[model samples]
Target: MSIVDTSQKQRGRGVLEGAFQVLDALSRFPDGAGLSQLSRACELPKATTFRLLEQLVELGAVQRHGTEYSVGHLMARLGENWQPHPRLRRASRGPIRTLARLSTAAIAVTILDGDRVRVVGATRGTPGELPHVMADSASVSRTAAGQVLLASQPRRERPEAYTATEWRRLRSRLRQDDAVVVEYEDVLPGVCCVAAPAPLPDGQGVASVSALIIGSTVPSALPGLVLRAAGEISRGLAVH
Candidate 1:
């Protein structure tokens, strides 16, 4: 092969193998792998690993701090900036299914958009009757899912943050936990939901998984269950 062709082939190999090796390490070990560890784990020489790390950093796909390397904001964009796929559902299915089966409630994974919580992934429970995952609910601020997600807002977004009585109430709830609920006030007078924060790798409330159950069926101590379910989902999400 000519000199130019040989150089191109070498670059291509580096790009393909280097990117995969870095991603695989980050995925398998969320805490991130240091340069030395990556060198050994990827079985690439330290010199080559250092070169690829620099390239990926420039491309915003990998991050290096001190001597460690890990998935970066670019990886997050790749995961979140796609058309709907089975991965989101598949990634979250375990917790959603567990919550629904354990609580006998409709479980859903939601993404927070500009002013809405979208039902990007859903799973129906037996005789699923409640519907908090409806995309249209994005407009209704009085519902359970909406209220819980709304609680996650910074001080500027609270309903009562600017008001007289409601602001005080909202501040109180926000102080307690970024989770809130006002039963029967949301959609479907008989159904109620509660939410917990699912802050993404970045600070954005990228998504929330919720349990929507009939008010009558909800036990007196159900809020704990709801909160725990959200916590489980958050734990499953690998931190970058």
Candidate 2:
């Protein structure tokens, strides 16, 4: 290719990357942020950030409110339509609701997305409207559902959440036991979680089901209930 052609292609790629950086930074500010805040967060120059923001706003990927900017309705619409694993999401909904009702706890269906765990489905609220513990995305090392998904990955493919030896041991145990329980102290003082893998027909675990219990003590049956729910989801997948 000609040098001019190559240069033009590189510039096009750079523009796309810069625009994505602006959008990613904006996502962290749910309530919206000013131009300066977004510029600093994205580590881009003010002029460049402003230009990208303007283009994004024009494209309907971002919304501007006087001086503040936030993710737009277009992005929300796209996210709502994104079904990475339609069958898994569809099959897990009923089981997640059933488990939540049975355990009186919030439930989440999580899947590995890039380097993070994404909540594909979740129970909306409990009896008193307790806050949902799982966000749209969570750390693979910190959450029980994330741990189950990480355990299935090869050591080399895993994120650096633990020391090499610790990761090896943890993965081995999770693979053997096929479940995990974690208690939170700092982040959610009175919360605990139980998770199990929802495997596909070939025994490949594609997702995890977790229950978020709000209390100091976890009922002994909670883990079993979570496991049963995971099994139901797996069976549902097999049938499809």
Top-TM-score candidate index: 2
Per-residue lDDT, model 1, residue 137, is: 42
lDDT by residue for model 1 (1-240), tens: 699999999999977978788677666667888888888887888888888888888988888778787888998788765534244445566777777777787776666565545665566632221344433344455555555556556644545323456645754674464463535435676777765555454465545566677764556555666667666666666531
Q: What is the lDDT of residue 120 in candidate 1?
A: 55
**Candidate 2: which pairs clash?**
none
RMSD of 2: 6.0
Global lDDT of each candidate: 0.63, 0.77
Estimate candidate 1's alpha-carbon lDDT, on a 0 to 1 scale. 0.63
Each prediction's TM-score versus the true structure: 0.50, 0.62
- What RMSD does model 1 have? 15.1
List of clashing residue pairs for candidate 1: 143-186, 160-167
